[model samples]
Target: MSYITGFLTPVKTENKERYIESARKSWPLFQGYGATAQIENWGVDVPDGKVTSFPMAVKLEDGEAVVFSWLVWPDKKTADDAWARMQEDPAMANMDMPFDGKRMMWGGFETIFQN
Candidate 1:
Protein backbone atom coordinates (compact mmCIF):
# COMPACT_ATOMS: atom_id res chain seq x y z
CA MET A 1 0.00 0.00 0.00
CA SER A 2 1.12 3.51 -0.66
CA TYR A 3 1.86 5.78 2.26
CA ILE A 4 0.20 9.16 2.16
CA THR A 5 0.65 12.26 4.26
CA GLY A 6 -2.25 14.69 4.24
CA PHE A 7 -2.31 18.33 5.31
CA LEU A 8 -5.06 20.81 6.01
CA THR A 9 -4.14 24.42 6.61
CA PRO A 10 -5.49 27.92 6.66
CA VAL A 11 -3.52 30.43 4.65
CA LYS A 12 -3.86 34.11 4.10
CA THR A 13 -5.70 34.64 0.84
CA GLU A 14 -3.10 37.14 -0.23
CA ASN A 15 -0.25 34.72 0.28
CA LYS A 16 -1.28 32.19 -2.34
CA GLU A 17 1.71 32.90 -4.54
CA ARG A 18 4.10 32.77 -1.64
CA TYR A 19 2.55 29.47 -0.59
CA ILE A 20 2.95 28.03 -4.08
CA GLU A 21 6.54 29.15 -4.19
CA SER A 22 7.20 27.43 -0.89
CA ALA A 23 5.74 24.23 -2.24
CA ARG A 24 7.83 24.46 -5.36
CA LYS A 25 10.95 24.98 -3.30
CA SER A 26 10.17 22.02 -1.11
CA TRP A 27 9.32 19.59 -3.90
CA PRO A 28 12.88 18.48 -4.53
CA LEU A 29 13.39 17.39 -0.97
CA PHE A 30 10.29 15.27 -1.11
CA GLN A 31 11.27 13.75 -4.43
CA GLY A 32 14.78 13.00 -3.28
CA TYR A 33 13.37 11.32 -0.16
CA GLY A 34 11.16 8.96 -2.19
CA ALA A 35 7.86 10.79 -2.38
CA THR A 36 6.15 9.55 -5.55
CA ALA A 37 3.67 12.38 -5.87
CA GLN A 38 2.40 15.56 -4.28
CA ILE A 39 -0.74 17.63 -4.63
CA GLU A 40 -1.76 21.05 -3.38
CA ASN A 41 -5.39 22.16 -3.57
CA TRP A 42 -6.69 25.62 -2.91
CA GLY A 43 -10.15 25.83 -1.47
CA VAL A 44 -12.97 26.77 -3.77
CA ASP A 45 -16.67 26.81 -2.90
CA VAL A 46 -15.79 26.02 0.67
CA PRO A 47 -18.61 26.94 3.01
CA ASP A 48 -18.73 28.02 6.59
CA GLY A 49 -20.70 25.77 8.93
CA LYS A 50 -22.41 26.49 12.17
CA VAL A 51 -21.11 23.29 13.66
CA THR A 52 -18.09 22.06 11.68
CA SER A 53 -16.47 22.24 8.28
CA PHE A 54 -13.14 22.49 6.50
CA PRO A 55 -12.96 26.15 7.35
CA MET A 56 -13.84 25.51 10.96
CA ALA A 57 -11.38 22.66 11.14
CA VAL A 58 -8.54 25.09 10.58
CA LYS A 59 -10.26 28.01 12.26
CA LEU A 60 -10.39 29.96 9.05
CA GLU A 61 -10.20 33.69 9.48
CA ASP A 62 -10.97 36.72 7.36
CA GLY A 63 -8.89 36.92 4.20
CA GLU A 64 -7.85 33.32 4.66
CA ALA A 65 -8.49 30.13 2.71
CA VAL A 66 -8.17 26.44 3.30
CA VAL A 67 -5.44 24.43 1.63
CA PHE A 68 -5.64 20.68 1.25
CA SER A 69 -2.42 18.91 0.36
CA TRP A 70 -0.93 15.47 0.29
CA LEU A 71 2.26 13.62 -0.48
CA VAL A 72 2.44 10.00 -1.60
CA TRP A 73 5.30 7.61 -0.93
CA PRO A 74 5.95 4.13 -2.26
CA ASP A 75 5.61 2.63 1.20
CA LYS A 76 5.58 3.40 4.89
CA LYS A 77 9.27 2.73 5.31
CA THR A 78 10.16 5.21 2.62
CA ALA A 79 7.80 7.76 4.09
CA ASP A 80 9.19 7.24 7.55
CA ASP A 81 12.74 7.57 6.36
CA ALA A 82 11.91 10.71 4.46
CA TRP A 83 10.29 12.28 7.50
CA ALA A 84 13.35 11.51 9.60
CA ARG A 85 15.65 12.93 6.99
CA MET A 86 13.58 16.07 6.63
CA GLN A 87 13.99 16.79 10.31
CA GLU A 88 17.76 16.76 9.89
CA ASP A 89 18.03 18.37 6.46
CA PRO A 90 19.35 21.90 6.48
CA ALA A 91 17.29 22.63 3.43
CA MET A 92 14.20 22.36 5.60
CA ALA A 93 15.59 23.92 8.73
CA ASN A 94 14.47 27.42 7.86
CA MET A 95 11.80 26.75 5.30
CA ASP A 96 9.31 29.56 5.64
CA MET A 97 5.63 28.71 5.82
CA PRO A 98 3.27 31.21 4.30
CA PHE A 99 0.60 30.25 6.79
CA ASP A 100 0.32 29.85 10.50
CA GLY A 101 1.94 26.57 11.51
CA LYS A 102 -0.07 26.49 14.72
CA ARG A 103 -3.25 26.05 12.70
CA MET A 104 -1.98 23.44 10.26
CA MET A 105 -3.14 19.87 10.62
CA TRP A 106 -1.51 16.78 9.15
CA GLY A 107 -1.40 13.02 9.37
CA GLY A 108 -0.05 9.92 7.65
CA PHE A 109 -2.25 7.20 6.24
CA GLU A 110 -1.93 3.82 4.60
CA THR A 111 -3.93 4.11 1.38
CA ILE A 112 -6.45 1.31 1.08
CA PHE A 113 -7.75 2.22 -2.34
CA GLN A 114 -6.91 4.43 -5.28
CA ASN A 115 -7.83 4.66 -8.90
Candidate 2:
Protein backbone atom coordinates (compact mmCIF):
# COMPACT_ATOMS: atom_id res chain seq x y z
CA MET A 1 0.00 0.00 0.00
CA SER A 2 1.12 3.53 -0.57
CA TYR A 3 2.12 5.85 2.26
CA ILE A 4 0.76 9.33 2.71
CA THR A 5 2.35 12.50 3.96
CA GLY A 6 -0.29 15.09 4.85
CA PHE A 7 0.03 18.75 5.61
CA LEU A 8 -2.20 21.52 6.92
CA THR A 9 -0.80 25.01 6.59
CA PRO A 10 -1.90 28.52 7.37
CA VAL A 11 -0.74 31.02 4.78
CA LYS A 12 -1.42 34.66 4.16
CA THR A 13 -4.38 34.94 1.80
CA GLU A 14 -2.49 37.36 -0.37
CA ASN A 15 0.32 34.93 -0.84
CA LYS A 16 -1.78 32.31 -2.62
CA GLU A 17 0.15 32.62 -5.88
CA ARG A 18 3.46 32.34 -4.09
CA TYR A 19 2.12 29.36 -2.20
CA ILE A 20 1.26 27.54 -5.42
CA GLU A 21 4.58 28.42 -6.96
CA SER A 22 6.42 27.02 -4.00
CA ALA A 23 4.57 23.76 -4.31
CA ARG A 24 5.10 23.63 -8.06
CA LYS A 25 8.80 24.15 -7.55
CA SER A 26 8.97 21.45 -4.91
CA TRP A 27 7.03 18.80 -6.82
CA PRO A 28 10.03 17.68 -8.90
CA LEU A 29 12.10 17.14 -5.79
CA PHE A 30 9.39 15.01 -4.24
CA GLN A 31 9.05 13.05 -7.45
CA GLY A 32 12.78 12.52 -7.69
CA TYR A 33 12.69 11.22 -4.14
CA GLY A 34 10.08 8.55 -5.05
CA ALA A 35 6.85 10.32 -4.29
CA THR A 36 4.20 8.93 -6.63
CA ALA A 37 1.77 11.81 -6.43
CA GLN A 38 1.11 15.15 -4.79
CA ILE A 39 -1.96 17.28 -4.18
CA GLU A 40 -2.40 20.80 -2.89
CA ASN A 41 -5.78 22.33 -2.11
CA TRP A 42 -6.65 25.86 -1.23
CA GLY A 43 -9.46 26.56 1.20
CA VAL A 44 -12.73 27.53 -0.41
CA ASP A 45 -15.46 27.45 2.16
CA VAL A 46 -13.88 26.15 5.34
CA PRO A 47 -16.00 26.79 8.38
CA ASP A 48 -15.12 27.80 11.89
CA GLY A 49 -15.82 25.39 14.76
CA LYS A 50 -16.91 26.11 18.27
CA VAL A 51 -14.55 23.64 19.89
CA THR A 52 -12.02 22.40 17.36
CA SER A 53 -11.45 22.96 13.66
CA PHE A 54 -8.78 23.07 10.97
CA PRO A 55 -8.55 26.81 11.46
CA MET A 56 -8.42 26.47 15.19
CA ALA A 57 -5.78 23.79 15.04
CA VAL A 58 -3.46 26.12 13.14
CA LYS A 59 -4.45 29.25 14.99
CA LEU A 60 -5.34 30.86 11.66
CA GLU A 61 -5.23 34.64 11.49
CA ASP A 62 -7.63 37.09 9.86
CA GLY A 63 -5.76 37.37 6.59
CA GLU A 64 -4.68 33.78 6.35
CA ALA A 65 -6.16 30.73 4.65
CA VAL A 66 -5.66 27.06 5.31
CA VAL A 67 -4.07 24.82 2.70
CA PHE A 68 -4.50 21.06 2.77
CA SER A 69 -1.95 18.92 0.96
CA TRP A 70 -0.72 15.36 0.67
CA LEU A 71 1.99 13.35 -1.04
CA VAL A 72 1.83 9.68 -1.94
CA TRP A 73 4.83 7.40 -1.68
CA PRO A 74 5.31 3.76 -2.62
CA ASP A 75 5.60 2.86 1.08
CA LYS A 76 6.64 4.12 4.48
CA LYS A 77 10.28 3.27 3.97
CA THR A 78 10.50 5.21 0.73
CA ALA A 79 8.68 8.10 2.31
CA ASP A 80 10.99 8.11 5.30
CA ASP A 81 14.07 7.83 3.20
CA ALA A 82 12.90 10.59 0.91
CA TRP A 83 12.28 12.92 3.81
CA ALA A 84 15.69 12.24 5.32
CA ARG A 85 17.47 12.95 2.07
CA MET A 86 15.24 15.86 1.13
CA GLN A 87 16.52 17.71 4.21
CA GLU A 88 19.99 17.72 2.68
CA ASP A 89 19.07 18.39 -0.95
CA PRO A 90 20.30 21.77 -2.09
CA ALA A 91 17.18 22.39 -4.18
CA MET A 92 14.97 21.83 -1.17
CA ALA A 93 17.27 23.90 0.99
CA ASN A 94 17.01 26.80 -1.44
CA MET A 95 13.28 26.67 -2.16
CA ASP A 96 11.29 29.48 -0.56
CA MET A 97 8.58 28.55 1.90
CA PRO A 98 5.61 30.81 1.28
CA PHE A 99 3.99 30.18 4.62
CA ASP A 100 5.12 30.25 8.20
CA GLY A 101 6.81 26.96 9.05
CA LYS A 102 5.88 27.32 12.70
CA ARG A 103 2.18 27.27 11.82
CA MET A 104 2.35 24.21 9.61
CA MET A 105 1.50 20.68 10.70
CA TRP A 106 2.35 17.48 8.84
CA GLY A 107 2.42 13.73 9.36
CA GLY A 108 2.98 10.45 7.60
CA PHE A 109 0.04 8.02 7.46
CA GLU A 110 -0.18 4.40 6.47
CA THR A 111 -2.93 3.94 3.90
CA ILE A 112 -5.49 1.47 5.12
CA PHE A 113 -7.77 1.78 2.09
CA GLN A 114 -7.88 3.56 -1.21
CA ASN A 115 -9.73 3.02 -4.39
TM-score of each: 0.96, 0.97
Q: Model 2: runs farther than 4 Å from truth? A: none
Model 2: colliding residue pairs: none
Residue-level lDDT for 102 in candidate 2: 93
Residue-by-residue lDDT tens digits, candidate 1, 1-115? 7999999999999999999999998898899999989899999989999999999999999999999999999999999999998999998998978999899999999999889
Model 1 alpha-carbon drift over 4 Å, by segment: none
As a whole number from 0 to 100, the lDDT of residue 24 in candidate 2 is 92
Candidate 2 has what TM-score?
0.97
Instruction: Report the lDDT tens digits of candidate 2 across residue range 48-81.
Output: 9999999998899999999999999999999999
